[model samples]
Target: MSSALPPASSGQPPVAASPLQPVTAGILTALVGFGSTFAVVLQGLAAVGASPAQAASGLMAVCLAMGVLGLGLSLALRMPISVAWSTPGAALMAATGAVQGGFAAATGAFILAGGLIALAGFWKPLGRMAAAIPPALASAMLAGVLLKLCLSPFTAVAVAPVPALAVIVTFLVVGRFFRLWAVPAAVAVAIGLTLAGPGSAGFDTAALALPKPVFVMPAFTLEAAVGLALPLFLVTMASQNIPGLAVLSAFGFRPAAGPLFRATGLGSMVIAPFGGVTVNLAAITAALAAGPDADPEPARRWIAGVTAGVAYLGLGLLALAAAAGFGASPPLLIQAAAGLALIGAFGASIAGALKEEADRPAALVTFLFTASGLSVAGIGPAFWGLVAGVAVMTLHGRLGRLTHP
Candidate 1:
């Protein structure tokens, strides 16, 4: 593993430069880049019965809202930060609604949660406290969260071997030559095959349409908000922003903690009232935008994120349909592409954790706990790993003190 690099704000801070010109082309390219995430969103809608029109409309709403916010805020902050609806949160809500009421109330819950985020961001102390978490813990949490998504492609291969293999092979080929457009190229191959026949195999060419927002008046209920808000915060922090910070730091961008949290907080507030839940800084996508492929000129990568945002706006209307769409197939192609795309990131995370010898045990524990696929008392592995690692470390240190004395 490479020696751990200092945090973005740790080393010499770059002379803050003027914002790069918006790269419309790169932005346009990135939307096509994250095609799989879009697919997953569609699949979630399908799970929710997300219906045809509502699915379409909700997806468009999510895409557009996220995209617009991502572009505007990213540009405003002069950071390559991107935005996306919380995938983990959406899954939670989809499951929640299935047993609870419906999406409408859940969306209402979404709004309340956004308010909580804004509160967290508004108070600088809380944000700083969050940032103070040990680097290894944060990295482990991120790796564990993403490892699940990274490994999911193999399952896809089982369902649709031929198509998945094709996608993987194509991705590897494009990765060798095209470099910048590698994963995108793989996705193109997958989309091409799917449209060739069977499931959603028809090419329906229609120019994209903008989303019409539906405002759900905030009905403040402690029951709804209490149930929904904490979970939203947890998903955003653990699944969304934490990884985002990891990506930012990985690519040598300074982790400007305050503004990033503030932006997510505010963004969540805007869309939560309308039906968008779990909006947060898009760490995974931001890595895609900030890295070499985002743009030849690193300065222009924010535009890639911006372009993704615009695509989000365009697709926001079909939110549920989008999730269903991804889940619709054996999803071999999506899995293949997403896995190949994240390979670089996964490597980086593992490398990051292994750097400090003292940190290795904790990191390994985290990775195992996360990859173990264990859930206890209704919480995921992230919390559990942290609990175990920290407990062990504290006890070991105390025992050493006692022995020395």
Candidate 2:
């Protein structure tokens, strides 16, 4: 499990490193992580009935939590254990729509979810259960949750053809060469179009204000707990935390899971009352810092995480500006950028779900149900999708045994 980079073939040494390699990687990871999904987070908060101010508060809280936790964990563990807001959890919230008590109820559920995550750190069984979830089913559930948002680009193009197309084309072209820069490039184009488009006058630069915390007293309700708390925990664990662990393990960095989970969970709880939903280990951005590209020496890779954490703190300061920009821009433009950012995640989830032939049927069932947006009671399609997939997988296993016997 040595994380050392492979040695050069010849006697000559590898290229001399720039001191900025880790720093650059950290900055890139933070940029990609924040720019790619902050819009989606705002949209998710809105779907759950957050006022513009409340949503801004939530965004700020999560950003600060992530930055602080990421920095602390990286320094303590000396591993690139990047932390992030749960994009899948946000997507699940978006799918759940507004609950009985509206945003307050949802906030309560968020608190409960964060508490559950923190408890899971002390409860070995809970952590084990999360880890034991079939990879196919987990991946399928994530894919299902992501499907709708990923399609927003097309929807945006239909509603606002020229601007959406410009963004889309820019993404495709830039992604072809500099894959990492694709979403940022698209975001820049979308912003440019928004500033120049017909309704541009509505974006009052003077009105843009720094983000401030808008606390909402949480009111716990049965419906919100069942609908939001349970699903949020599941999606965050399945789609974000587990995958994040896997990414780190792939790079031969196996820090204790309980401490990591507890750190993020506590951070989430600290910010929940302020509108932060959940923060967890980051899967996508972790790879950028953990990889050899960040540092030739694996032990030194933690520097990238530390750098990213510092960068995230800077982004947190600009949360208000980001909120204002998204608020003033055309919804389609925001949707288009968010959708483009998630395209790779969608593809990865699909591939992960279908990688095993035996699990394909179950995975497809999960994806279909989740993508269908079916909600029974207050529970979202994501939870039901997991249920369906596991049921199918179990039945398929039993049938195979019987036939073979």
Cα-based TM-score, every candidate: 0.68, 0.93
Q: Give candidate 1's whole-model lDDT.
A: 0.58
- Please provide, for model 1 over 87-130, each residue's C-alpha lDDT reduced to its tens digit, 9 standing for 90 to 100: 65554343333313445555566666666566667787655445
lDDT of each: 0.58, 0.85
Residue-level lDDT tens digits of model 2 in 176-234: 99988889889877877887788665555643567899998999998888778887888
How accurate locally is residue 120 in candidate 1, as Cα lDDT from 0 to 100?
Answer: 62
Q: Give lDDT: candidate 2, residue 269.
A: 83
Residue 354 lDDT, candidate 1, scale 0-100: 73
The numbered model that scores best in TM-score is: 2
